[model samples]
Target chain A: MSRESVVGTAEHAAESEWGRLSSRLILVNLAILVAPVVMFLADLAITGDAGLQALITLGSLFVTFLVVSGIGLMRLFTTRYRVTEHSVELHSGLLFRSRRSIPVDRIRSVDLTANPVHRLFGLTTLSIGTGEQSTSASHRLALDGISKADAVELRRRLIEARDARRGYAVPVEDDGPISELDWSWLRYGPLSVWGVGGVLIAGASVYRTLHELKVDPLKWGFVKDLEHRFGSVPLWYGILASVVVLVVLGIAGSTATFIESWSGYRLTREEGGMFRVRRGLLVTRSVSIEQQRLRGVELVEPIPLRWARAAKLNAVASGLGSLDDNRKRRMLTPPVPRAEARRVAAEVLGTDRSLVLRTGLTRHPRAALRRRVNRALMWTVLITAVPVGLGLWLGPGLVRGGLIGGAVLLLVLVAFAVDAYRTLGHGMRGRYLLTSSGTFAHRTVALRQEGIIGWKITRTPFQRRAGLFTLGATTAAGEGVYKVHDVTDAQGIALAEQAVPRLLLPFLERDPRSAARG
Target chain B: MEDVRLRPPRHRVESRAVNWWRLQSLLFAVPLPLTFGILWASIPPTRQIFMWLTLGFLVPGLIYVLVMPPWRYRVHRWEVTDEAVYAASGWLWQQWRVVPLSRVQTVDTLRGPLQQIFKLSGVTVTTASASGAVKIKGIDHAMADDLVAHLTRFTQATPEDAT
Candidate 1:
């Protein structure tokens, strides 16, 4: 598709270095050929087709290299480029003519990169991304020998144009000194919450395997064999053996928690009114979020953390997906000292944390009772198994072990009740609504009254009898799951109405006056 | 600041001719892919089937491309108006797009070996959208310079079209 004449105006005849840049296409092809050669060599060695394979491999490589080099050289000869006030034009091709022009406004982002080869030449590749592409492209423009100063100037011009079009005042100078601020780092490290759960599960598997192997005297096979070798073992003795095993497993759970909390940490802060966070180990990521995008803020206080007065804070933002990936998602504050948590929250929400604080949202009486009962049952069954099994295996040696088992069960029950009571004393207080639930890792999430997106209240047959309804509040930031279970239905609806107004919307739309008032 | 080049409008291809080239190029694309596939196929029977299918897809496309071409080099022409660039083409199903000088994102010139041999160039007008992008083939190289200049000046004018 050769044309008869050139299609650009005389002005486009200005100096263009596209030919020098397109010559690098040879290097690109050289990189592409390495893979096929390695594969061919590996195949020849494995298949023992050395003579024929070597000949074919060399021939293919030679042909491919020659073809690539020829194409690149031809492109270098034909390629031409011109920059107009409104656009940058690139004209290149051999048999087929292809020209591309990109307008300044359409260039979404410009990236400067260097590979080892380019670094050796003190050169950089300029890659421009146009957001208009339906599918994301790896690169839209790859220009070589673009000076750093030129890249910066291009970026500045683009930014200025974009800002002017958007009716936003352009900053006087991007690099001019601004107030120095310390940014908090948010890191999700190597050890995560999932790691702790995995360890506990793995340990349980080991315990289960050992028990099935009749390693414990509580096992039926072990008891029966012992009785056959000696006499009938008492039931009380058998119960004692089980208690020791349960204690070992309980310790494993705590150990898992400690190990998992060792890493994967994050820190967030509000600096210059934009929320910024830093996280990662292998590849650190930093995100700067314009504050107006935040939809809402949440404080999640888990059961274990309640005693320590520790809580995790998360912010929901529109356009960004979730707090887990700050690049595309919202940002979350790192687990900070309990004393400083509210201060950070206040900064992020642009309000005094105390203003949202309400009283008495914590573990209810029923939850407290259930936690105690479960713990007591678990310990009693465990602590009594070993000694009782031993007694049973020994026939008549320990007849009083049954009595000890009953006593131990009572003691465990009492201890569990105390612990449950102490834990239930923990509570959440916030302005809109406070919710607390959980036996193992209880959480209390407080939402603001005006921040709710929608509200629903549902009651099951059992819950109806118990005079309890589950209250759900949806927010714009799409916190999909929020159920204040067993709350008064009327109160839940009332809370929702109040919170919807205060709920976060995207920060971009925030009126400074309204935000300040808020 | 780096000096920006400005081209005159007369040298650029009319948008209609570009559209014609696109339709022609699209029509040309059908047969080549089919031929390439057939040649690449290892099975003879599959290759034959592919060759027949390629012919079937190419015939209608070629006829349509030729019958109502978007561009007729002998007749198609463009003018850079004060506010817009008017380009029109087509023997039938005539179509025209008035590119507001302000909306013109880029003006580019291209030359291939064939173009160099024939002393011709191709011009591409890249708008923000893929569907509306225009490419004019077999144009005089001098025309590209004019079109680029005309478009750039138009884009820089007061963006008074929409507040």
Candidate 2:
């Protein structure tokens, strides 16, 4: 029977209808497995390697493909999903048949993704997230290679069902989008550390791959000529020239990636209290997060972006996925002007003004600065000692190099320490608690005060001597713990009390003698 | 400076927890010296160095077994109130954690073989946040049960989503 006829009959016969995934999923799976084999065969044909061994290898590959495709076909036919009044259920697997039923009210997010191949086939993968902290397989459900339209319909139906269960007011009319891509934001792309880092990583991998194949770049005539040219120039000038070239290439690469990843980026607030992000050039993505799950927003400014007056925004939400996945899925906006980042953050949090961007953050005590400086000095001694000790054992030529490197390192590290101290601050504004820190990548998190579930106070021997402590406000959002480093003991207690008023009062004591009663 | 300190949590653990810790450390400590002693006797060339190693491990392990239990007893404390649970743990590097009753997700009592020998149980109070779990070890078994019951009641009373 046709898929539609089967679904229609099930709907008429039962309270919920079982729907199959797109049959084209089998073709897509086979194509993914076959493409590489075809390329390998083409390469063999070009090299005229039609030996008996080659024929045997090709036969085995064909057999493997058939076995894999058989499994894929069975999976495609067996998988089915159905939505009832109170829950959504999925039944799948061949030898290890399994069933999953998730309550409608527990569903937290519905995300749609399609790579270039899937998009070419008009298919998308839908993942249903319940926001459980456990990473067990049963907690995750993904429908692979469904028709894009069907995926969208399923996502909407699931969300609507959840909203209905929660007794939410009916969804209102769509209000355009909250934010959209601004091409000018691409200017900040080249200012990110990733611009240079990405180039280095890609270049290293390509070189390594060639080396693995016994190809040497140094043996090439053009590379030898370039080396000769560099040899003739002064050492510092040659280094400068190479750095300039690397930067130019890095900028071009980052700008291209920025365009490809965020070409049609749009952030829209959907009808039923969900925020949807749609972006990507070739492999499009649509992520929908329940508005109620968002605990806060964070404004991230790497050193280079901060210097360029730019920043990015991320949502501090629960159930985005594991820590790494949460970080990737939480991106609300790519690098944008600081003002735009703040505006978007404010919009996302539904606040009048972005509290993290506000001024007059409470400065940490001077002891914090002392602690940082002490740590910086200790690191300098440890690092400098390494090279100096090596030089002493090696030769005088290395001694001069060690001295110069140590001098530069000392300057950079001391400056970094001071900047780290300066960036540290914590404050409360309205209903949100704000904590800002980090020097390499400064993050100012505006966490909802009501969302703070616990407090952790840590004191090291050094911190005890300085009368300073680190206070971590624990929540289920973002990194789970946003710490205010090197605050005085009194300040940590005061801030914790102020952030969650009555939780700590019962445990606090003003006098030591009275503390004996606990 | 005096006003800055936290009032230590209310209750000390069962005193026999010290013996449990001491036995646990001794169990770990005996292995190293024994291994080194066997090596020293079996290997001729490395005997001198191995002998020194045996002494090295044995001396410090003995000291740790003697010192750590009582020191940890003084440091580890826990108190539960109507509104929140508070705990202080660790020696040298210390931490105080406070989790509100409204945000508690689960309360579990764990008793290992050694803890059973000492009639001690450990209670773990989990909040919505992964890192916000408060663990109180070395409490009387009966006291741990009462704490778990008390916490469960408070958590159930506030049936809001902790996240």
Candidate 3:
């Protein structure tokens, strides 16, 4: 059928009409393409250069704008989508002519995103995720810009259709949002690695940009004055002052980012068994995931957050899209009080209490502790050797420095190793298999037992000698594989078999005497 | 303290796999010493140390070439049953993987140039999870084809989402 005829018939039938994108997309495209051209023209006007060089640059800029805007305009005109009984179909491309049809049942997620520009025009971009593993662009189906109301309505219809087809009970309307933004949660904002990391990244980018522009920041009057002041101060005092300054800056930067990204965060369970997360101040995002796809939940407590008794929650779900998208959408709650995080986790998983909060986890064998300490010792020696070697080649001053650093490092590493060993544990709780580990960022992942698809056991020569192995439970959700590290070989095998019964039982051998006695 | 509960998988890979691994290791080990020798002969400044460097690289490289292939052959094994496919690989860092037949998504036979020279092939069984792919390497080419067929038939019989 011709495109025009299809649209005509659909409009007459009042059924499935070929939906066109928001006309505002053309303005968005033009604005993006023209901004740089406008800047270049402004630069040209200020320089008062009207020579042939200027003429060529202006002409080239115009042609580039024409080509880009032409493509954008063509895309805007050709792109059309419609939801049929079985599939969501998208047709686009003027010259090449492409058509894509994703089965309604396979649609895993429907996400709506609106940046500042899109928000200005009351439009949002909709991405329909099919849960395909391939990272190719063809597998991604997105409608660039549509009215916000329309996007939300379309998301509801698509998700509802899938639920209805699957014979799931589709709620008529969303209940009150399960979780909403709390201003007091800002206390945990600066207690994240991102605080220091954000400051470093911003500083580095600023330095690079200044260098690229051929400007020396050190030449600035204030910077030179500060350097002179610092030179007079004692070395230790100057170091302390700098550390204080960096910490303050890092706190400010992280808090600002936290507010900007999560000002009005809301997690709501919509009518069609979909959990929707809506957040962001400037660039708003509304990500929806089918409840059926959720396999479990993960409670993450990074060292800094753990010190503050704060934690974050993430959903372990399938069909959330590529790895990057999956990570962005998996966030169930920002850093909050550990108790609040546990509450939200339980609410999201539709349970009374968070599974990870349960006690009596099966701790790893003492051999695992020995393994960790051995690893820590090996790392300490390897790292200390670098400085020691440099000291030998250089001077006695470096030798003193290396010895001091090595002592401090050994102390820290040994503590970390002990802490890591203490944190290692795995256990079965009802239908979920809980594995908790890591010293840097303790992650307590509660994965549904049935979600486990396969098992991978790895043992190094040292681990084999120690009678320990790392067991990874592979699933289609979240991180794909969650590992329980440094368990005894017997413990690892028993855990795997218990987690997924029939899957590994056939492959395992039992003692003939024990079998006969049983 | 090997666990008596879990035995090694049933079948060893093709015996000729030792030669293929030896050739593969040789390809990796031969170049460094040869390069050092050439540099030592061509460059005057490198003469003092290059001879020692060549020996340092050559001695260990040759020993590794001699030892690794046979050790790897002893370590590598695979088995397929009605319910699951099991594989054990690697020498120093050993791995054992098991994927149920119901979760098998794709079964492919891979033959690299070295493998083709020895008429050996590898069977890769992929599951839904990204990290759940299991490879049975260094099998007879014809046997690999038969294994793939067997796995495919078994997988097709059990209909599930695999996720």
Across residues B12-107, which tens digit of lDDT does each residue of candidate 1 receive?
Answer: 443445454655567576667566556647567577777766677677767666554443553344455665554433333232333444445567
Q: Sorted on lDDT, highest at the top, how do the candidates line up?
A: 3, 2, 1
Per-model fnat list: 0.01, 0.66, 0.64
Where's the lowest-lDDT run of ten residues in candidate 3 chain B? B1-10
Task: For residue A223, give model 2's deviation from the true position in Å.
Answer: 7.7
- The alpha-carbon deviation from the true structure for residue A373 of candidate 2, after best TM-score superposition, in angstroms, is 0.8
Off by over 4 Å in 1: A1-193, A197-273, A303-307, A322-331, A355-434, A448-450, A500-518, B1-163
Ten contiguous residues with the weakest lDDT in model 3 chain A:
A1-10
Q: What local lDDT does model 2 show for residue A323?
A: 62
Model 3, B49-128: lDDT tens digits are 99999999999999999999999999999999999999999999999999889988889999999999999999999887
Q: Write the per-residue lDDT of candidate 1 for residues A398-417, one digit (tens) a residue.
A: 63666576586767676656
Off by over 4 Å in 3: A1-16, A33-67, A172-174, A210-238, A510-518, B1-4
TM-score of 2: 0.88
TM-score of predicted structure 1:
0.37
Per-residue alpha-carbon lDDT of candidate 3 for residues A1-518, written as tens digits (9 for 90 to 100):
22221222233434348787888887877666565466555545555455565556657767887888788788888998888666677788898777777777888889988898889889898999877654543467888888888898888778777777777866546568889999999998887678777888899987774444334578777899999999999999999998899999989988887887788999998876788888899888888877877889999999989999999989998877766767888998889888988888788787757578735789999998988888888898898888888989998788888888888998999999999988899988888888999979999999888788888889899988987889999888888889999887667877887788877776667646456776
Candidate 3 pairs with clashing backbones: none
DockQ of 2: 0.52
